[model samples]
Target: MERLLVVLCPELLEEQEDGRAARTFAGVVEVVESFSPAAGAVRPGVCAVPTRGPSRYFGGDVRLAGLVRTALSRTDTALGRVEGHIGVADGLFVAVLAARAAGDEPVVVPAGASARFLAPWPVEALERPELADLLRRLGIRTLGAFAALPTRHVLGRLGTQGSVCHELARGMRSELPGYRLVPRPHPATAATGDGSAGAQVRQAGFWGEAAEAEARAERALGHLEQLLPPDGVAVGRLQGGRGPAERARLVPWGGRRLDPAGPGPEPWPGQLPAPAPASVLARVPASVVDGRGAELEVGPSGLPSAPPEQLSVRGGPWQPVTAWAGPWPVDERWWSRRKRRRRARMQLVTSCGMAYLVVREDAGWWVEGAYD
Candidate 1:
């Protein structure tokens, strides 16, 4: 219905700091209809914004996209350097692919031709494994190949999803968009993203300084611990913009010491390593995504039962179910010997709804799908 843009830009700072060969390219997309990360930028670095409303107000999709580009350019100079590559297709997914296929100029996928454009791409591009595997087994490789097959057979083979893909071959990308749940990044002594806090980094160097790291770590823990209730749950999911491996470093204390003098984490040896920037931790709070229509209900059986109205989770009266749904009984994957479970069903929900699952499991209830 509209032109979705995937703007590719080169960072001058990275080049100036390093070399021309070390150019860092950024893709800032203007997503008119979805909340996808690739569709929009939603972080400290860059983001994507939807254009549906803009299109309605500005008379057309092209004008909406143009307005977005202008807004992006004006908001922040660094954010402004975006290079426009437009993809006009029936849906976001197809538009993005069309844009990807475009070279330097803005690529546009004309409406009504999305399904045809997508036919040549690999089956893997669809991002749905269940559908991809079934198609691959039937000797279908490209979207076109699958499209050429009997629609009824494809649907029967892959279930209801195959019909969507069949239509996609004709250039109708109908899959939902993807949005990145930006995890909260833990604050580091070296990290200056947040200001106005006590024990500033340079004021207290993390490693080289005499006890600053310990102090700062204490302050952070105190901040976190304060968030916990006194009598109930002790260890709850910690949510931040960062992941587990990306979790912030805390100056370790001796069991229950409130204020610690850093001799360098006692339990943590001097040579201990830090986690990767992208590492997501089990302790870290996972993101709960929005699912339209269906509602999640935690059955009264103390465990998840057949389709319920909504699901409920209480992490020991502390963390509660933020959202949930779906015991959407998946009877497939049974053919695979590895998947030969007495019973296997996936509860499609996020950490919020899962907290209750964990508590119930800890209380001797049958555990179900995790936030993972």
Candidate 2:
């Protein structure tokens, strides 16, 4: 019912790791939905977490803030003097602005007094360079000065961003509807036969779906044996059959692309460097049928196609798509959009990290999924 405590590390922008550290940092606060990079190199990390649960569980917001401080400060040495600061306010945007202002040191805006606390700060507190410049040109240097200016003039001059800057400069935050995080299951959708024969066969989910797909792709790409590095190293990954495709979003909304080279605490491949996190597509079943009619059924034989047009997934920094199945065509009613189903479809996954399926609608072939 109160404000969420936001913890920040200005220097965190320099830490070149995956999103895990940034996510873990938000976990220090509450449920971490996702982390967004403001600008330069995904650095300048900012995490948003709910405060009610932590404040209640920890007895109070002040204590919760202290706990966050302890968690962030308790890190490995040699990371340099990276200070983690905590700021508490009525909302996330305000807390972020306040946290940025109190850099390298902790500060908590008193409950219900966020507006008062932000009144004296500079217009740059909102961090919009262009808007800040415009405001300065208009002689509005401080939050108090901006607040004194008319809202109509603000909006007319700067558009929506101006309205946002004004609201945030006054400790007001845009209300974001709360949403839930969907779970991403590992990819290995394998079909294994029973010890006796086909009728007794069963398919078990593999532990590492990404690796399996990658291996399958690498094997399929054996045709390019000479192109492969002597070490069988891979270049990148693909999401559909041998040909190019498009993307589709199902029940799960937005996905966090893991940057192997981004700001994470742990190194990828243990000591070896890793690539930055990027967006991955989710592989969702377009249609389902009885076992007898399943395309890539629970049996071992997944959808396999000819060598030329087959898309393979290879692992390394990128992957390739080897084979494809389905167009086991399906169509479903889009409840939200209230649209009737019309496209034919199938699924594709490659070794590296791309997961997709093709829609054979009149529009030709289009991709519909990628796993994160």
Candidate 3:
């Protein structure tokens, strides 16, 4: 069975100016990921998190919901304490509706009760104006009324989109015929990291002034320069840099950075291998780690064994470190609705003095990469 959590933040950007709203939402998504990786933005003020996996670790659904609420409450988005609703259910439609139905607390629908919980809600909750109009005309105002109609008849008249609506009304999976449904930012107007079309504050001309738009765009390039790692150099700089007008055309606010030499993201410094995704460990060890990555002790099973003794090494059959560097942290995917990642990377030199990249994530520690 699928499980979903809907976080409704009506005031997420109510206080911000044009550009700041998108940035604020990005920051908010980051906070959600600190609680679970299965979360993503549904819209500007709404986010959906799949909690089935993470909830088990935090006890049960109710307790996990409480923890999520606490996290959102403690999150200082600098936009103030915007309230959030946490709804856990079998489907996104009922889960979101349940969130809106809640007060200052969370709502958790039992495994198979989403359809029943959704039944009494009015057709308006579907948020489809045209379909609601049709349903009203037919005297089918509540979701239960709409769900009672034969699926074949609905499909014959309203087509695939109607099929989706019917499924939603019945609290079933919303997918079109012969197609796998892909998740989208709920309420389509929600801006992705790069901003939306016709609402391009950061991607296009700032504040929509055609005059000096090029100049503003040129200045954005300057901002991009500062964001890159010290070792990160534009490819254009290597092959005779292109003019500002050419660079200005690239979208700046998108999560993917632009390369002056080409259109794609600027290559990672020295083309370092990106972090490899791995299985979450069933058990995490307790260990003390600080910047410069020294005196780490781990058990044979690759778990942090214990706190390090000052100036003394705690040796085990596992990889013993001779030297180390970095607690270099990564906070990736903050710009999109699907926020992910909270981990620190450390380079360790084993007894053989061979270096390995290790990561510490919420799920536990794992060796990320190896130096050749």
Candidate 4:
């Protein structure tokens, strides 16, 4: 589960008739956004930000929480003074509880301690009133007691909803039902022209349609970054190679900047034709045989001893080959003795209408890729 930092305002949880709570919370979100662009409003008076990157940048989780608390202190809101409670923990459910528990100092739950920290909490913390009542009647009044029930028995006796709660009790899932909300745009800041209290004036041309599109893209990316592990997101760059897997490589998406488009695919000698395979697979042992049920071989001259008539993958039943393409021989790094590779590749369509890219090295055959 991803570690999260939550900011909760008890006073602003419920909106007022004048909409002061929502506008105040939006200001709180803006303050949190200064620390991490991935910060998002979970509700009117609640917000969360993934702490992985920011914690490292600010030295540690304790320091990061302190900085966030200090920054939120200076934010002016319609409610006169903003009171933000900060907490850090793994997953959203426990993190929100941690925020509520915080007072003058931010609460930081140590890593890998979510289950232990949640064990003492009441079953009501799960927020399912029916489940909590049933568990209490069964003598399971605490999270630890509820989690101790056998998972299979829980599923069989209580059905899917109970199974979901079981996972939450065991600290397996990150969020509770309805914990995350799609953030709505702030009505005050989105207003323009009249120069109202929080109105943001917009200019034309470069800051018009293109700028709005870019801002939307950035927000989408920020939300994506929050869900993924630190540095987990990447973009693929195509390069010259013989096989589909080698023709492209994944590079980390750094600094939240998109690279300019590159030139399209270029012709390379011995490379496969256009319309590459849809999926690249690990080296799966396969069998390629002739009509006589004899294993086919690719001789030293890079020519097959006999035409392939059947193919079997991972010891599965053999499927008849309906159509086939050339044995494109690749002899790379020939100058280096240990680094050299000599292999033959062929594209074949099976009787089941599945297409595969199979390779032969020495006397062994393997399925390297598949076509949609």
Candidate 5:
């Protein structure tokens, strides 16, 4: 693979938005023979350019990086001091991380040493929060340990995502999975007379599991309601399931039918923005039934408070459940000596037919949320 140089603007967002980043990036592009934005933006905070042409024009990778930095320094002083870190490595993933670690100086990972270069970093550096959490629970603390895992086993548990992380740990070519919001094209490049040029679309996925993929799709759709213009609507099919064949039409979410009487807890006045509608509680107290079917009440301190009969929400009135599901167990972050969570969740319907997600963690059982 050709050595790729990654240029990262450490504080692009803090810089003036009136073309400062673009002008600086355009300067680098003028100097570098060939380059591409890693993502869709003209001046993405991070970009990769092949090092061959620039290295040959200058003395070497180090000299090429210095030249690019000098170009940026001269490009725009209106934005005040703008500095970038450059990393030269074999692949985009390592190159990006290397640039981040480079901090004002250019760092070059020797060709064929990308894997070794990445091995010492913590697995958390992978940046896929979910996959990192799973790895932590499995006792994989560092990239080297994760790289040592059998590929087949990682695939079986994490699916395509696991495979991607594994490849990164080994410093191989791999596509990062998950949703990415694409920015609109720069006005100078946008063509006239076509509404299509401004039409926006949000893309997400390539998830390994059907359920998780569907959940993410639903969350994405819910968010659109807030993102769209007042009179605008998004029209497209959510495509997933086994292959390209299975797809579902997008529709307004008519939330769960279970409407509880009166209102639940109102937001106690606060400056914090309301939590995202789909966020799950980090900790919740609940009435749990173990694998042996023994019922127990978990309290505010996350300790068993009483037998099943006395179980109730931490501070709410005792409401009887009409039906209940299993005590499905979940254990996460077990590798972290202090952050492990061993818990189980249950689906329950109250006497009024309202459903709730309740969880029992080491901290104790609590209600996660209402079904609706």
Candidate 6:
């Protein structure tokens, strides 16, 4: 788990139509960057700095916190009366809670004391509603209680997600799911009045070997750009949606480069669980049938008429469905009679060892995508 110092400004969390919060938060990030060059915005009004280096330079975590708070106080009157809460802990998750618990002074959880510091927090602090509800029902209301449960039992009961949360409760993991946002360049290092080309020229390479590798990669990309048509070079950018296809878009390269390694889109209400499919295909016609070779269909209640037995893509020979999950219903634009849509999606694994995502509409089944 990486030790982090979280800076949260309650006043600048919510964005207004005028984007005042964003601008104010940018100023806050700038101030923190002055202390540590690695400070990054986790979200609007929430930023984190890796404390290892900065703590050493500033004499210690406590003194570092005090110095930051003093600096922020000096900027409050100039930058819309900002109230900053600082917390230093072993991980991002606990550090955020420490920040929230802070008052006028910074909260510093001792090194190697993350589990003890987190023991008293509610299981709800894990921010997983379904798991929290289950734990509450099982009389496991506190993080300590959840952590005490046998790992095998938790994994058996809740699967991978439960195991992950259990690790968090035990302080084995530092970050909460979705805590990271896409990395946006700091305003000071971003494109200046000179041009976007200046931004590209300012590559980040901490070592000589890495710098040489980056230069080689840049040269290769430059050659590729000259060889390929403008539309041939593209990259994927994430967007908000429930399905893999809807959540990503392919944009022409040489614009803003979005890091694929960054965190995914924020969780959507009806989104499929992760390990997203490896490929998203156009809606291709497919055939699905039950054991008796009867076509399967989804009813108005979104339940399948019969269990899926086999699938055939584009009239290909049927492959036996070895496993399947879901009739995850889609009811969009429900308030509007004319625009309302009703559909269901299912994951099917065939005997050929291939998995596919298929959707059922009023017309019939269509293959939406496939998994690796």
The true-versus-predicted C-alpha distance at residue 80 of model 2, in Å, is 7.4
lDDT of 3 at 217: 51
Q: What lDDT would candidate 5 get against the real structure? A: 0.56
Which candidate achieves the best TM-score against the true structure?
4
- Overall lDDT per candidate, in order of appearance: 0.41, 0.45, 0.57, 0.77, 0.56, 0.78
Clash count, predicted structure 3: 2
TM-score of 3: 0.46
* Per-model TM values vs. the true structure: 0.35, 0.38, 0.46, 0.54, 0.44, 0.49
lDDT of 3: 0.57
Candidate 6 TM-score versus the reference: 0.49
The digit string of per-residue lDDT tens for model 4 on 96-172 reads 88898899789998877777778889998887789899999999999998888987587556644565677777776
Where model 6 places Cα greater than 4 Å from the true spot, the runs are 77-79, 180-372
Candidate 5: residue 27 lDDT (0-100): 47
Per-residue accuracy of model 2 over 1-372 as CA lDDT, tens digit each: 236555566544322344344444334323222211221111224544566666677777677666666656654434433466667777655666667666655577777776687788888766567878888888889887887776657544554446555655554542211111111211221223223221111111121233346435534544443454333433333222221222112210011111112332332121211121134333322323222432222222323232223342331232344544454533445454667554554555555545554444443344444434
Arrange candidates, best lDDT first: 6, 4, 3, 5, 2, 1
Give the per-residue lDDT of model 5 (tens digit) for 130-237.
888888899988889998987657644664456556866776642233322234554544545434323322211122133336446645654564576422333434
The alpha-carbon deviation from the true structure for residue 267 of candidate 5, after best TM-score superposition, in angstroms, is 74
TM-score of 5: 0.44
Error of 1 at 193 (Å): 20
Task: Tell me the spans in candidate 3 whose CA falls farther than 4 Å from its real position.
Answer: 13-15, 174-372
Worst 10 residues of 1 by lDDT: 356-365
Clashing pairs in 3: 41-337, 42-186
- Clash pairs, candidate 5, are 284-365, 284-366, 285-365, 285-366, 286-365, 286-366, 302-363, 302-364
Which sections of candidate 4 miss by over 4 Å? 180-372
Quote the positional error of residue 183 for candidate 3 in Å: 15
